[model samples]
Target: MREFCDSISSYVSKQLKFSNISIYQKLNVVMSNKVYDLQYKCQLDDNVLVVAVCYFTQYLQTQQINKISAALNVFSTCAVLASKYIDDDSFQSEFFSDKLQIESETLSQLEMHVCQALQYNFALEQNQLVNIQQQLDEILVNNSNTPKMSFLEE
Candidate 1:
């Protein structure tokens, strides 16, 4: 999902005539804050949180420092959004409050800030899944045989 989100952000930045590397650099700066400490905070055992971090990094790449606080909110929202897709259960305000050691109301407010910063552009596509699935399908040739471990070994 993060790969997909990053791809979309890259496309948008190219469309906007901005430097993608600069956006990545700026994200690094914004993420140096305590609020961005969620990188090591989520309890999930999956890669969703990592993906959320990538999304946040890309989103931060495109935003200004004056918007960093709001961008962080959007990062949280994207994390929840990505969780909905990658995790089995949906994350709610209570879930965030319990997981991130914050209050439910505070999570709600942060979500609001994220929405405002993104202007609600939360429907970004994650094409990595589709691309990988398509490639696997082609290799399988619609046969019932399962794919080998070679793909994973790489």
Candidate 2:
């Protein structure tokens, strides 16, 4: 029954040229790309990606994501925190400001939002990381068919 309903919805969405992709799926793709870009641009350790994904997921659970902008902000904030927390590194604020077209100060504000949402605790146990890994795997499988959307255009 669920599959039938989804197929009907997919068909109607396609017929009307509406996006069938859910916001969460879009966020998943955008976040993965952002993490990859960070890895390439910052020469970051692989652990940073892991931490960022975990942090972003935790943030999502605590907050309601109603807009793409909010989702992106959380991702950027999580990425910055992950870099700082795991590598003792700072965000290349200028680079981010240029790319995100927001003031460097906005990053700080976003970071604070994420920190508060996460209760200011950044610690992660081995079991927590393992659980996060499983969650990520699930997201990957579920989002496999997510149609490509331009994050910038959203």
Candidate 3:
């Protein structure tokens, strides 16, 4: 889990050219922390996190996010969409915006942009979600011994 988060943080940091690495760290913290929180808070299924990570990676690759704020918008929007698609209960933009410390209007706009970028294809087959979970599990197992810090703790 930590490795996956680190790779995403490095990728976003480089892509956005954040002058302060702390921005990327904060983004990583917010994403990891909130994803876990939503899993319990919304009574979301475990697959929701897998789908959210997949959507986040896809969004990062396809979108041109030039700032940390843009990256947060994308991440937060993806989380909301993923939960809606994967879980019985879904959170509103205001809920996620408060968690991410962003404005609700910005999150709504980003959600629209993300939906358009994805061509409105929000469906994830069961097998696809399973595969993503498997891959992430393998990563966690391989890096099990490595000591790491939660970005949230920093």
In order of appearance, the predictions have TM-scores of: 0.43, 0.64, 0.65
Per-residue lDDT for 12-121 in model 3, tens only?
Answer: 34445556778767766665555555555544454555566667766766777766566656765777888777555576667777766678887788888888888788
Q: How should the candidates be ordered by TM-score, best one leading?
A: 3, 2, 1
Q: Kindly list the per-residue Cα lDDT of model 2 for residues 59-149, writing each as its tens digit.
A: 7677766665666566667767887887655656676666655688988788788999999989988777666545444444454564422
Question: In model 1, where do residues sit more than 4 Å from their true spots?
Answer: 1-42, 65-77, 126-154
**Pairs that collide, model 1:** 73-114, 74-114
48-139: candidate 1 lDDT, tens digit per residue: 54345445545565555344344445656557656765666665668767766557787777666655655665454556434433443443
Per-candidate local distance difference test: 0.48, 0.58, 0.62
Q: Which pairs clash in the backbone of model 2?
A: none
**lDDT of the structure predicted as candidate 1:** 0.48
Of models 1 and 2, which has the larger lDDT?
A: 2
TM-score top scorer: 3
Off by over 4 Å in 3: 1-45, 145-154
User: What lDDT does candidate 3 reach at residue 82?
Assistant: 85
Better of 2 and 3 by TM-score: 3
